[model samples]
Target: MPIITRFYGIIIKMYFNDHLPPHFHAIYGEYNGVFDINTLEMTEGDLPNRAVKLIREWAELHQNELMKIWEKKVFKKLDGLK
Candidate 1:
């Protein structure tokens, strides 16, 4: 997974092999959660209150770009491409 966003001890990311429904993972140390790009849904797990708020803001800020990336089904660079 690539570290797409970072703030408040949380690292938001996505895997090259992640499935559709357009989501990314928010990881805080040993904790993790899934956030949907479309509906802005916290699909799985969570973070502390302030962290969650920050993440929500981050997600919203990049909503359009995230969805654009997801919909295109593009991965930054796969292993063999190197």
Candidate 2:
């Protein structure tokens, strides 16, 4: 997995040549969740409430960039939420 961003100890990543629906993985400690870039819905696993909110906000802010990267099928590090 390649980390695209990190915020509040939440690590956001995506696997190269990953599956469909344009999603990313958010891992915090032992918890992990796969979130859709377009819908911002958790597809698998779970995270803490604070982590959830932060991830959602960050995803919303970077949705476009996320989509672009997904479309290109590339793994690049992204700036963390500020």
Candidate 3:
């Protein structure tokens, strides 16, 4: 997995040629979740409420860039929540 962002001790990552629905993985300590890019919903797994909220907010902010990268098939770390 390649980390695309890190903030508030949370790490966001995605794998190249990954499974469908356009999603990414969010990891916070022992907690983790797979979030759908468009819906910003947790597809599976779990994380703290605060962390999840932060992640959703961050994802919303970068949705356009994320989708662009996804379509471009480029794997690169993105700036975390700011």
Provide the TM-score for each candidate, comma-separated.
Answer: 0.77, 0.91, 0.93
Candidate 3: worst 10 consecutive residues by lDDT?
Answer: 68-77
Candidate with better TM-score, 1 vs 2: 2
Determine which window of 10 residues in candidate 1 has minimal summed lDDT.
73-82
Q: Model 2 over residues 1-82: C-alpha lDDT tens digits?
A: 7779887889998886888988999999999999999999888886888888899999998999999888987777788889
Model 1 steric clash total = 0
lDDT of 3 by residue, 1-82 (tens): 7789899899999877888988889999999999999999998987988989999999999998888777788976788887
lDDT of 1 by residue, 1-82 (tens): 7767666677877766578788988887777788888877787985666666767778777888777667775644211100
- Whole-model lDDT for model 2 versus the true structure? 0.88
Query: What lDDT score is found at residue 65 in candidate 1?
Result: 72
Ranking by TM-score: 3, 2, 1
TM-score of 3: 0.93
lDDT of candidate model 3 versus the reference: 0.89
Error in Å for residue 12 of model 3: 0.5
